[model samples]
Target: MSPHDQHETPGIDLARLRPWFAEAVPQARAEALSATLITGGKSNLTYRLSDGGSSWILRRPPLGHVLATAHDMGREYAVMAALADLHAVDPDAVGLGGFGRPQSFLTRQVARWRKQLAASYTRDLPDAVTLHAALEERATAADAASRPGIVHGDFRLDNVLVDGDDRLRAVIDWEMATVGDPVTDLALMLLYTRLARLVGPEIAPTPPTSSARRRSSPGTRPAAAATSATWASTWASRPSSSPRSSRASTSATWADRPSAPASTASVAERSTWTWATVSSPKGGGQWVGPGQDRVLALIEEVGLSTFKTYVDGKSIYLRGGKRQTFAGAVPPMKPSALADFQRLAVKLEEMASTVPLDAPWSAPRAVEWDSTTFGQWLDANAATDEAKWLFTLAFTVIQGEDPHLSSLLLILFHIAGCGGIEHMISTTGGSQESRVVGGTQRISQEPAKRLGKRVVLSSPVTEIRRQDRGVLVKSERVTVRCKRVIVAMSPADAGRIRFTPHLPVRRATLQRRWHNGTESKLFAVYDKPFWRDAGFSGSAMTDLPVARFVVDNSPPDGSVGILLTFMGTAGSGPGLTWSDAVLDDPRARRDALLADLTKLFGPKAAHPVRHLEQDWAREPWISGRVSTRPPGLMTQYTDAVSRPVGRIHWAGTETATVYDGYLEGAVRAGERVAKEVGAAL
Candidate 1:
């Protein structure tokens, strides 16, 4: 019977499947076919397809959203069903000699899973990174000790089919099947049995053990029990229901399965793609230790604060008015004026919504947004002074530039499209929710410690030149040659490097044009968190010239009080006039900050014990904190930002497609370049 004559299956396009199935298995020539949905895991949709005399299994990605890498039917097909009798067949003898690259298989597996995990990143998972690093470090040794063979990636009791006589019939669900260490297959099988016991029989039902000691299972195997235990704990917090690519939310209950335990569900809904069974090359061993390394694991490991952000303490100060609820200046101004401001804010956001966030850079809509400045848009749309001042303050505080200089598209992308005012202000679990116990200096310091002498401290690279099969990097004190180099710096810093061949005209021009925002950080320390007693969150926004943005920077214990102030050096922001003089003179800067703090949080703010200041613009090598694309720049040559140039690859926050100019973006960029370089090698 034709596919059109058959009842439609939710996932199967029967019309396409029938012909393809017929071609792949020509012996199954029965005219009629039927497919029944198989009850199973949420990762892939499986169906039992049948002709009158024969039945076959068909699997594909989940219905609504599919992560491309997670469900590869081609990968499963490559191993073939005939090889499922792993105990009886030899792969090389069966014309499967070129099935997979077995060299350094363990090392490659570590890198492959790390890259995959990066793809599905929702938030920070330090355990994932640490686990990856540990695995990678041991992979080389592990590979050398192991013998390569056709490995069944996920060998378990459930995955194997048995005849009525209780003899081995066939193994199934070979999506992760590949040529690698045979021990990995045996290990994963044992690990599953262990998981069944540890997580409880209800969630992970298992068959009776071969041993007479019923309590003893594969988990008790001494060979790698310690490693397996660690791996199990790592996975216990990970959601196994979803594929590597699927952005499975915690709220999404798995279909045809019991709900995951609260301990696992509460930790993270999304899987970190740590199957550790992928087949790919170990991303090359060229090491250039540039610096060091967030979310929950970071907070615990680094001893961070969990202070609740107080909305009452977060006040917005207006000229000649008392500080009030940060509700867009409602208390200080008339209701009608505040109402106009609120209306205009919503109107502007709605206008920005017209332009899609993911529109191509070359699209007319994107071009229009990129070309128009926030100031220009305000002049046309914003009706009242209240609207103009509030919008401008929010934009300048968040973006580190005045509305006149920043692109409307940049604002829309970072502000309206991103999350709106709440995100910018750092509400609970927002960007500014917590601070590392120590300064972020520890981020670079920890990695530098690991790298030891490999990290050439104070040695700045001045030039880079392409050589035979590699590139030459020259620093002030040392020079090195490597196969490829990831220049993990902002465009401005990258532009300072003298390339021997001179980068492409567009690339060079882009680097030169990519300027940094004049943002500076200031910290005022005191005896105790006095503002908390005063019903203040120690967070404030003002039109003050010295400090445009303020937040509580106290330690987790609250033993000492601190107020972090963000000031801009130039443009139409409030800090434009006072930033220069204050940044130059230490005393004047502290005095100015205290004056503003006092005005915002009362007299107690004036008597700080210590002051700390960091003007990013004045910092060496790192000219600024973040790269800011100006009007017309992002659209003009943004293509060259991430596009590789021969052996030279780029990995910076700016090159990231998501959360660009942030730490998260930087990590994502590093993972992307690692994969690119690995493939190239």
Candidate 2:
């Protein structure tokens, strides 16, 4: 095939590799070397090269057409090499004991990420790609750097690991690592922390409680103070390079981090909470979803150039299939929509500058600010009463209350710059349909296998009985005794646990008040993508009574058409609906949904061969899909939401700082708590 026609880059062969490794590190460990590819990375290729026992990961640029800013394997290797030794005496980053200037680190990463996304657009998610292309243009990068230090370009929990004692085991996948601004590493970590919270613990195997990252976090702990005894002796011997440019070694560090509880939980409380084993619904008859023209038209009509200003009316953003936060920024103002969006940016930046993520509620700006909800915040800033659609689509709509209350911090963190923020993170955001080739099991099975543990399915946790020593986690199939436990499931499901000492007043309040917004996804499968032929991008968003967000999740080859759509918000929307009563009659539900889709995509949308239904609220272990904050609740209890109590640490997308209701939040929460738990342990 012509190279231009090729979608992916050619895979490297061992015949070409043996010589390269021999030349790169002649001291050699290549006796009968073999290479196996690693899966799950978004834009690069990774392989595990092993000679009998030990394994080292090898990474390269993406196989298909790649953007100039997309990958730099040399930079990654240089960072790791600077940290680790040449099999002799080298200094490792984990050995440094602490980090320096994290705020500056975050600002730089955003700038770099924006650059990468501007030039690259993949085939699967054209809609998100287009919005992002425009979003990047309006961004104003944070200018908070002190001095340059070693920066790990893509510093995330998944890329790093820890030992049993919670020390940095290795900072792998250095392809993106570079020395310029070390603080960017911390910034990226914080950004990842925010994004991961949307998806539960974003990192796998690595607990959210790891100490290495905690040190990197700005407010959590002090950095560059603690010194590992062996630092000077080993690092002094290395060839000279800039402190920020040259890498540090990884083999030895002080190992001075704190420890966790000693005794494990009781045997009885260690039973199974059957969450990971919900079986897939069976049916030769297809489960239909939706083809989203409403959302796409919203994006196209709004035009990313000034979507944030509310000039084009409504804006729709989608990855291959997931929805990030959607809506307007400031309410409409007289001076011009573009000017208002720019003003909105200034307001958010002020909030970001003034309101600390750690104590947003107590921040003087919020304390003295007279706004109760986001609607009020907008109105105070000049949005009219009828311009309530921004809050209506983004946050929940509560009855009796005008302008719907919401957490100001949540708004600042999520929708502050709108397209500007999206442009910064879009490279990693999106459906990533190409990577999901592994399916759901990829999240748990792969991690379990690497850690030498088996994924025991079927059994669900019935109760978590707290003991003097630890907690007992029990399920119908098995019981586990552990010193500490990370409740990684949704708050709703976690509340079901029977805590022996019971949760604290704040935690109990959070458990009592937190509720998942009711959401339903239905798919209409057809023989072809009928809408695509009609100049449609298959994405849509609306104020329609029932279904709102819509998109097309068709196969790459287009064997069959898939139109995915969403409906139902807690305490809102038409209840004339498809909850359980129509479970038996899929057609009835399909027809009802089709009426709405037909309105957006013409009468053709009403005809589908089959329908697919996914009730995220009813998922076995996870009781809900999206965490919805109604008016006044989120800000009141935000503090106690993710904090650890004794040996029990809490995580879930709800606990994340950014995109709290998305998959990214989940990953972030998991990684953060994993580090916390790891260090304590």
Candidate 3:
């Protein structure tokens, strides 16, 4: 019998457990009580209970036998209680709520559920065995050290709840909580997350290893026996005993092999919910739904051949021709992959490029602002001097030739007035005037330095043939081999550059999506610093465009100046190409911006001396904007991006940790790449 098929055994009753709760928690009588079982997970049974208006959760060992160290309810309660105390004071710390002592009645009830699950398994699942073995080995190998407080042994997502506001309301399930190694608790949490994705949310109790069971003597307490019995029952209910058809057995056998391809079809057919396949080329076949021609056409359009050798779901196929699985891991593609895709996507983009770029055309939206409240908000959120310095570096380079120098000076003056420079000097014990002057000089020098360095800029590099001592940078230019080559470019560029011996997909993916910042930088220059005279600082009033932000750069000299604006929308790339001619024409659609600024400030703001702008789209040497990240790409590819490929190392704004999109990011990238290159030597 499969664990799912096993008959449920009667265990302890909730009514019996209620007395313990009532006695232990004096507040229970005043609270309304309700109980519901949350299914999934082997070894422990978890329940959610509400007392009066307050919600609480309970957890206990599954019915029958369990491993001795597996489910220690006492430890879980202790840890949560300790953490709660800390959480009350420090909201940033990882802490959960109130805890209670173990209840014998609850323990018996959980044991019964475990027994049912263990007994239900009619056939053995080799995959389950392998996974258990891996977990046990990892646990044993980890250092046996005490952590801060109690560890939640089975800390899976279901055991945790988020309220309507998306705050983690509570963490329940104490059966596996312990005072041993905190790493073990972390491991268990990770294990549960994996198991939840593999099995349904309701987990079947796992049988303990023979060594674990033998270690538990007859003198074991009821709790220990309950845990052991659950494990034993689960082990006894393997699926191999079932009289499965040859086809069913074959399918099971294939599934048991970790390397075997999961069905790349719809949930209706395979009954699997995996985002990996959904985003993959193999999964693409299922999306076309029997339309082979359409599937083939889509494949051709996407250039599936380029992705055949990649892995981690970004690549279409992996070794052994299996569709890469990205579920529960990072998403399939890296930022670099997207960059490469964008490169390929350009061909398609060009066909549509002729179409007029769309912009919202209407009178500027009105925003009500309370001056006092707005001032307080600024004081609260204003970047520190360090942050401002970093921001200045970042924003300056993107400002290019037509930066609003006067506006920058005014901003600096405002900063000085706000005691920003003074604070910086006091913190660092440096000369305030010198620091300000130095910072200003650095900002002024950045744009010219970036544009001054002229190199043979290449795009879509065909190959980077490597010799023993040097690497050849092959583009449209004749191959130039050097003792070393610094591939301070995008990951897509690095990936396309072929090594003498081809680099691994891991290395290639690292290069391509190394620093995946798809952010947008927009510049809107004004005729003069009219806003300042009107009592409005250059800063704007919104947070739309996600990262949409504006800075006032009206020249201090009262000359024509510019306001640099950044719109952080993924689709906002086309806006970079907005030229002076486009904005200058009285009949052009954007002419109203001039009118709006004039009305908002004064007539002098009607036309900018020169309205210069750039969207990351037009930047060829640097693809995309600074390295803003999506959810999972950063953690997944961090190490890979850091690694060097052959004699070729990479340095780009995206590679920098300190100032990723800023000039600081560039400097950091340079330093890191230099270190890697030096290390290789």
Best by lDDT: 1
- Give the number of the best model, judged by TM-score: 1
Model 2, 1-681: lDDT tens per residue? 322223322465665566666665455465445655555455556555555544545567778887565576554544444463322312234432232334445444456555566556455554354444332321212232144455556665565433345444444455554434554466566655544432222112233443223111111111111121100101212212223211111100001212211212322332332112111111111111112122223223333110110011233443223433333433223245446545655665667565555555565655434245555566567353323343344343111122233445555544432223323222123222122222332343344334322233333456666776665666543455566777665566667666767788888877777655555567878888787776565656555544555556675556788777665433432122334523333444555677767776778887777666665544434445455454445556657877887777777666766435444455566668768877976
The CA lDDT of each predicted structure is: 0.58, 0.46, 0.36
Candidate 3 Cα errors over 4 Å, as ranges: 1-461, 493-500, 511-527, 543-548, 554-558, 568-589, 595-599, 602-604
- Candidate 1, number of clashes: 1
Q: Output the better candidate (1/2) by lDDT.
A: 1
| CA RMSD of each candidate after superposition | 26.3, 24.9, 26.6
Superior candidate under lDDT, 2 versus 3:
2
Lowest summed lDDT across 10 adjacent residues in model 3 is found at 276-285
For model 1, the stretches where C-alpha displacement exceeds 4 angstroms are: 1-316, 325-360, 571-585
Which TM-score value belongs to model 3?
Answer: 0.32
Query: Given candidate 1, what's the lDDT at residue 435?
Result: 41
User: Using TM-score as the measure, what is the rank order of every candidate, best first?
Assistant: 1, 2, 3
